[model samples]
Target: MADDFKVTDPRTLRAYAHPLRVRLIGLLRSEGPMTATRAAAALDDNVPNCSFHLRQLAKYGFAERVPGADARERPWRATARTTSWDDDSDDPAMRAATDQLNSVLLGVFTQRAQDYLATRADEPAEWRAAAGFGDMLVHVTAAELRELTEQIEALASRFDDRAADPAARPAGSRPIQLIQLAIPRGPVS
Candidate 1:
């Protein structure tokens, strides 16, 4: 896994708003280096289409060809451990594009949650025992909300060393997605 985070340009950010591109990036980050043929098989996508999108991803600096693969088979790896963008971009088009990208990401997150819920029963007893779901409605000021999110991020960082080095992970552990959301609803009159 990569240790650095990349900030995207507006055009590149908009390009990532495509659903397949989003899924491909997530797959690369989670599963590591893979050829377009392997990626297409994993996603049930066509190889040529996956290759075209992988090229677009490489063109935008999101992914790159792995070193020392067979001359004919190009294996690609994600360029960054993760990516970030300025969601508060002042430019109208950039802000709109960011909003659209965020919505697509939310859909992906929700779909992952649904998939987990659908198949969790098939998981080992220990994993099923450790899984969870919870929600709360809290009263808080905007500043408090910011502080809350920051604290949560800091806590999550404690377990993130493994992202940069797989050796940092202890034995018997498997990947788990930790989705966080703190949406603010408008005040009712």
Candidate 2:
């Protein structure tokens, strides 16, 4: 599948705006390929629902069947290492759709974080120590914020290959969910 990071069409954005589809893409990306049944089990949803959403994600180029999987139990994987959308689309409809998609995504992210925090106590002490949670207010210029985002992206890309080759991952390297958000909290005083 051709991997286009920036989604420009409203229809595609709207298609991905669903909660299940968003989580499905995230699941595939993080945990590697899985059949609709496996994904459904992990998500606590029905197989048909998972299959339908996976197809919808595939329709928009977010995911595709793993090449070697059989017709009976096709495992789907993410088409790209990352999904990006243009928040500044020239088309009003697409722009509005993008905004709605972003809102949905923010809600999804919030849920993931909350779930993690709720279960964090059950995790081992090492993991508990390793986890991070902070909501600091930083002062920076627009260019500085851009650079910060770029630097954070670069830092996270260090694991882009781990999804493809589990052997390449160093021992004790565990998957860590990192969410970075930088929004202007009102105008600078």
Candidate 3:
């Protein structure tokens, strides 16, 4: 198992916050190691462009080339369990980039979910019954919320590692959308 990397530095956060770079990281984090050509195909981006972002991701210490892979056809994977941004002080550029990246990720996943629903609309009743898409509002203490996030992250990590295995998964085991959110109930008192 590889050691987990931390992203506590502001400069590293800024580097990883770029929309495309973040997407690339998320893709690798979720899908495991992949070549630039494959990443480009999955993202609908040019290979060179994706390669550039992958290099930037590598430079930022967010990703690294898998050892023994072809030099010309590099495969990359996320180096850390999490890449986070801390907004202790207002920095307009970093804030804007984070916002934009968040929007891009939401939009892309939303579109993907829509397409999935559309494609499965006419499927068997059992398939339709098994589908789930919903949200909830919850109230919790700050410490409880942190605990919940950590638990969810641990669950995610289990699947993230399993995704790297091609033979261990069933054909019907499609990627499920999991968006874990924790927001304040209202304005801080």
Candidate 4:
């Protein structure tokens, strides 16, 4: 079984936000152990570039080279299930970087959604039913909001790990969009 993990530090978030670093982490988390070469192939990137980012991910404690895993076949996996940042910080640079990273990631997800929708015509019926796209507006307190976010993240992680299954996958077994929104009714005291 995979270990339970959490990251709630700004430094960790910054480290994991690097484009290649995040891609590598996602690759390992989804595909399991893999050599730098394999990771590169999975990401459609070069080995040296992937290796460099992998080392950076390790430096931030987001990942580690597996033991008994060959040095020549350096495989890595995420040390944490989630990475979070403290929004109360006053550091300008940290704030800017975090915002930028968030924006870029959002863009990535948007592109992925567009691509998925574009290919839906080619997808099979079972897959179309299994995968869905929708949004909801909910009213909740701060604590309730956080809990909702965590629940959604957990649900997404479950599906993300299912791609490795050998069972026959639905034709549209590709990615799906899951956007959640929780707007407060008024200003908090």
Top-lDDT structure, candidate number: 2
lDDT values for all models: 0.85, 0.86, 0.74, 0.70
- Candidate 1 per-residue C-alpha lDDT over 1-189 given as tens digits, one digit per residue, 9 for 90 to 100: 456555557788888887788889888998888999999999889999999999999888888999888998889999887888877678988898888889999998888889899998899999998987888888898789889989988988897877657899999888888888888778743
Better of 2 and 3 by lDDT: 2
Would you estimate the TM-scores of all the predictions?
0.89, 0.89, 0.72, 0.71
The TM-score obtained by model 2 is 0.89
Error of 3 at 85 (Å): 4.9
Which pairs, if any, clash in model 4? Answer: none
Whose lDDT is higher: candidate 1's or candidate 2's? 2
Clashing pairs in 3: none
Poorest 10 consecutive residues by lDDT, candidate 1 = 1-10
Cα-lDDT of candidate 4: 0.70
> What does candidate 4's lDDT look like per residue over 90-182, in tens digits?
777677667766766666667667878899888888887877676666667788989988987887776654455636456535534465544
- Output the number of the TM-score-best candidate: 2
Q: Which 10-residue window of candidate 2 scores lowest in summed lDDT?
A: 1-10
- List where candidate 3 sits over 4 angstroms from the true fold: 1-3, 81-111, 114-127, 151-161, 166-171
For model 2, the superposed segments whose C-alpha errors exceed 4 Å read 1-4
lDDT against true structure, model 3? 0.74
Tens-digit lDDT track of model 3 for 1-189 = 244565545566667666678678878877788998999998888999999999998898888899998768778888875666554437776666556555666676677678778898687777688876776777777778789889888877776644667677777776666765465778655
- Encode model 2's per-residue lDDT on 1-189: one tens digit a residue: 334456778998899999999999889877888999999999999999999999999888899989987778789988876778777668999888988898898999899889998998899999889886878788899889889889988998887778668998999888777887777999676
